[model samples]
Target: MSKSAVSPMMQQYLGIKAQHTDKLVFYRMGDFYELFLDDAVEAAKLLDITLTTRGQMDGVPIKMAGVPFHAAEQYLARLVKLGKSVAICEQVGEVGAGKGPVERKVVRIVTPGTLTDSALLEDKETNRIVAVSPDKNTSVWRGHRCKAANSKPS
Candidate 1:
């Protein structure tokens, strides 16, 4: 679908999603953070949250799912534990503060390999982040890296 065909809010979401295609976008909408389209579908399944349609794009309904902002930490912990990364898109401006849609941005990106939240970690054990990458020289070669990150309250 053309850019002009989508709502301004969706346009903003698309712009951010484009930058992090590999991660789910948690778009802030009022008291909740919403996931749309494919993100909604996947999150609904993984998080066992309600999945519904909001609007239409092109010729299809826009799938959507959301978690209350106040309880987002639990949902986020679940996703991170399930090996999913999330781009937390937050509303950075007041409603109706601008001529267009409320301004939003990816305030933080939480990945399994970059977890630093105290609530998501075990109380007594040291938490760690692990990463693996394919080697450049040979097809079968790969490298792994690990780092310990002490979780702290945010």
Candidate 2:
């Protein structure tokens, strides 16, 4: 399949996924958050959800998996607990707003290190954010050189 063969919606998804290759993309589609390709494969295994092939992209089958929009919180919490980052892509435009696919954007990126949502955090545990910076100055140590003394053979 060629680039032209790919659907507009998929093209939009690809564009977002390209920017967030390190995170699983929860792409909003209708009433479900869909994951595609490698995201689909990894998320399906991690979330214990069904993995199915939707269509094709560039001659390869496009793997897909999804969770219902209404019950996404539990799934998201689990993913975060297991040290996975997710990019939440939501439909920003109305259904009848335009002629082509409705405009969508990544509204939020949730990661294990950046957990702030009450739903994703534990009630009793304390949360901390740590920032590590490299030292800009390099230090040089000075040492005294010693001359070797000649010894007589015994």
Question: Which is the leading candidate under TM-score?
Answer: 1
Candidate 2 Cα lDDT to native: 0.86
Poorest 10 consecutive residues by lDDT, candidate 1: 145-154
Give the alpha-carbon lDDT of every model.
Answer: 0.87, 0.86
Q: Which model scores highest in lDDT? A: 1
Model 2: which residue pairs collide? none
Model 1 off-target regions past 4 Å?
129-154
Clashes, model 1: 0
* lDDT tens per residue, model 2, 1-154: 3557788888889889989999999999999999999999999999999999987898788999999999999999999999999999999999988787899999999998878787777666556665554455645444443322223222
